[model samples]
Target: MLKVTAIAAALLLSGPALAQHAHGAQKGPNGGPMEDVAGVHAELVVSGQTVAVNVFDEAGKPVDTKGYTGSVMVVSGGDRKTLQLTASGNALTGQAPGPVQSGAAITVVVKTAAGKSGQAKFSAP
Candidate 1:
């Protein structure tokens, strides 16, 4: 009984670490929420009609955007829009054709030059 209780306590204590690894509960370097997708880190930031996604390596250093491609999907108030993202400087950026609804939920999927893909989710403030 004591061994079982100990095992349960250990699992409970490790739950957050497991969850974070699976769901990326880390904050981004670009002042946005970040997620871990397949060991890469992605950050999503939304401003008005513009959406930016930044990718980082496991060590939190910004990854080169060269040859990287991605897409963004904005969801708000039951409406959804998809935008193509291009590498700009060190980040992937795109603009919505129409004004982005405030408080929209943004999801970004990025593929690196080596073909590794990662995604991040954020909500516009």
Candidate 2:
């Protein structure tokens, strides 16, 4: 009984350390693993006048957005516009509607085939 109690205590103490190390394997904000927006893995990228978003599954696989739909709200030129997003293959890309200067805040919401919704927030580069 004493040996079992000691083993249980040791296991409890080591559980947190193991979990912390496991979480370390996940990617950080700067384009490593997909950023978790709300409860989904989403990626945000700004290039020229377009903002590209890549949504992935829970297993870190790119999700096909053939019938998926999404929208983006970006603060550009000191104003915000709700832009419609269209999914191409595994990505959802859209124009900012108006000219977006650098360093603008953008928020995106996507609904996948499984009726699961996810959001991702980003700033223009």
Candidate 3:
């Protein structure tokens, strides 16, 4: 019983280290911050009043946007706006009601055709 308790404690202690490894440092191909979502990478790029979210696989290859639906919430200058994204080639694009400035906080949530879903947070670049 003591051995089992020690093993359990060790496992619990290593959980955070393992999780950090799984989501370790990632860089977007478009010079933006990248994050893992639903086992894939989501890169966010914002310009003027348009925001583009490009999805890529673990290997950094663009993923097909077929049947993918998503939304982006951008907060800038103390104003928050939510924009519906539509599939466009390998990326999803949306036009915000107002200009999305650099360093704006953003949250993206997506649902794939396969029923997989995930959300990621980023700062507009």
The lDDT leader among the candidates is 3
Stretches > 4 Å off in candidate 1 = 20-27
Q: Each candidate's lDDT (Cα)? A: 0.79, 0.71, 0.84
Q: Write the per-residue lDDT of candidate 2 for residues 1-125, one digit (tens) a residue.
A: 99999999999999997654232235534353345644456777666677767766667687678877888898866688888889988778898755667777777788876677767666665
lDDT of 1 by residue, 73-116 (tens): 88988888889999986688999988777678887788888888
Q: Ten consecutive residues with minimal summed lDDT in candidate 1?
A: 18-27
Q: Which residue segments of model 3 deviate by more than 4 Å? A: 1-9, 20-25
Rate residue 8 of model 1 by lDDT. Answer: 100
Counted clashes in each candidate structure = 0, 0, 0
For each candidate, C-alpha RMSD in Å? 2.6, 6.0, 2.6
In candidate 3, what are the lDDT values of residues 17-94, reduced to their tens digit? 767524434567787677777767888888789888898886789999999999999988879999999998879899
Q: Which of candidates 2 and 3 is the stronger one according to TM-score?
A: 3
**Candidate 1 or 2, higher lDDT?**
1
Q: Could you tell me every candidate's TM-score relative to the true structure?
A: 0.79, 0.66, 0.82
